[model samples]
Target: MKIAVVAANGKVARKVITEAIKRGHDVTAFGRHKENNTDASKYVIKDILDLKKEDLEGFDVVVDAFGTWASEAMHLHTVTSQHLADLLEHTNTRLLIVGGAGSLYTNKEHTETVASGPDFPHDWLPVANAMADSLNALRKRNDVHWTYLSPAANFVADGEATGKYAFAGEELTLNKNNESTISYADYASAMLDVIENGQHDKERISVYAD
Candidate 1:
């Protein structure tokens, strides 16, 4: 498969790009920063917001790993989502987004979301809300093929990658130990699985440690 990963400088995205290449997929990385000794066949160093439709033509999928912690720049999450959606509208390529857990439902009835939970970090509200807004926007678009993959509540940057994972629906997923957790590496592997299977299109999926 031919894949393009945006924001490849990020921790999670770097892992995705590397794993895709290991699997012998044609991979191109797009990001603002230059990377040394990257495994991707091509690296396009440009601000993601500046990417035009012409620049992203002819790919199987575009994995959007765009994220930000800056409070004033949080709105860019939705902005970037809209831009990419518009660019990829009705195209052959699918848009796979790296999403947040804050928007995942906490109850079977779907009355509340993880953001409403008391344990959610206050400092994370900006980015969480921004990501939720982008997801909500995607839910309304029928022109683009898209998928939003949300990590567990305890998403770890450098957690152990046991090479195992499990999937869940809209509700926040917890394991037999009653914990919501996933490693960045595991998430990357699961993401590629999703891409390869050609399932879960136009839906939001969750992943947690198995």
Candidate 2:
């Protein structure tokens, strides 16, 4: 499949692009910076916000892996989501967005993980809240096939791609030790699984270690 990965410079995006290439998929990597590597030449240096509808004309699947760093403001996520939605409106392709954990819930009416957690950083709240709003807006659109993949509350950089994880909708999943966590590699794997398998369209699903 031909895949277009936005924010190809990101850690998760880089891993996903590498895996996609290793799996023999033709990937169009879009990002702001061009790295120094063989795959770096394959990247198209462009800002997502500046992308026109024609810019995304020929991709099979579009992955919104572009993310704002912890130090950056949340407006970036909101703008990216809006731009992605606009781009999707012009294509027949499927969109797989990488969303934050703030939208996931441990209960029906509460969002304890990131929205109201004591450990949740106060500075990152605006961005998290913006992403949550973006997800909500995307859910209302029926013209495009979009899926939101929210990682666990504690998605650390450690661990390998075990390829063994649990999925949940709206509600958060807990591991044996009663914790929520996942590795970036496994998260990328799961995203690709959904892309290849064509599952969970027009839905938001959360993944975590089990």
Candidate 3:
């Protein structure tokens, strides 16, 4: 597969690039900052908003790992998602987004999203809520083939791959210890699985530690 990863400098995007290359797929990495090293065959140093559809041509899938915690949180999330959807519309390329866990429901009844829960970090709420709104925007799209992958609640940069994971619908998934978490490596694995298998189309899929 020929894959284009947006925000290539990010932690999760880097992991996804590594995992995708390990699987023998061709990768084109795009980011605001240029890095000295990457396994991606091609690199585009540009802002996601400035990227044109012609720049994204010929890839089998485009992974929108674009995210921001700045004051324009909602604007960045919504604009980037909408831009990608418009760029990929009526094209064969699929849009796979690396989303947040905030949109995942916190309990079994599925009435409350994690962002609506009391424990959701106050500082991170802007970005989280913005991402949830982005998911809502994707859900309403009919022209683009998209998949939004929301990681576990405790998504972090520091854990081993374990090469294992489990899934849930709109709710936060937890392990036997009731911890909702997943390694960045395993999150990359799950995203690649969705990309390669085309299992969850036009929907939000959550992954967490098993």
Candidate with top lDDT is 1
lDDT of 2 by residue, 1-210 (tens): 999888887888877787788778898888876662325346777889888788888888999986775545666776787788878884678989988898787576764646767777887677678788788888888878889999998787767989888887787778898998999888888788888988898999998987
Please, what are the lDDT tens digits per residue for candidate 3 over residues 33-78?
A: 8672566878888889898989999999999998888885567898
Candidates 2 and 3 compared: the better one by TM-score is: 3
Return the number of clashes found in candidate 1. 0
| Candidate 3 residue runs with Cα over 4 Å from true position | none
Candidate scoring better on lDDT of 1 and 3: 1
Candidate 1 stretches with Cα past 4 Å from truth are none
Q: Give per-residue lDDT, candidate 2, residue 153.
A: 84
TM-score of each: 0.97, 0.89, 0.95
Every model: Cα RMSD to truth? 1.1, 2.2, 1.4
List the lowest-lDDT window of 10 residues for candidate 1.
Answer: 33-42
Report lDDT (CA) for all predictions: 0.90, 0.81, 0.89
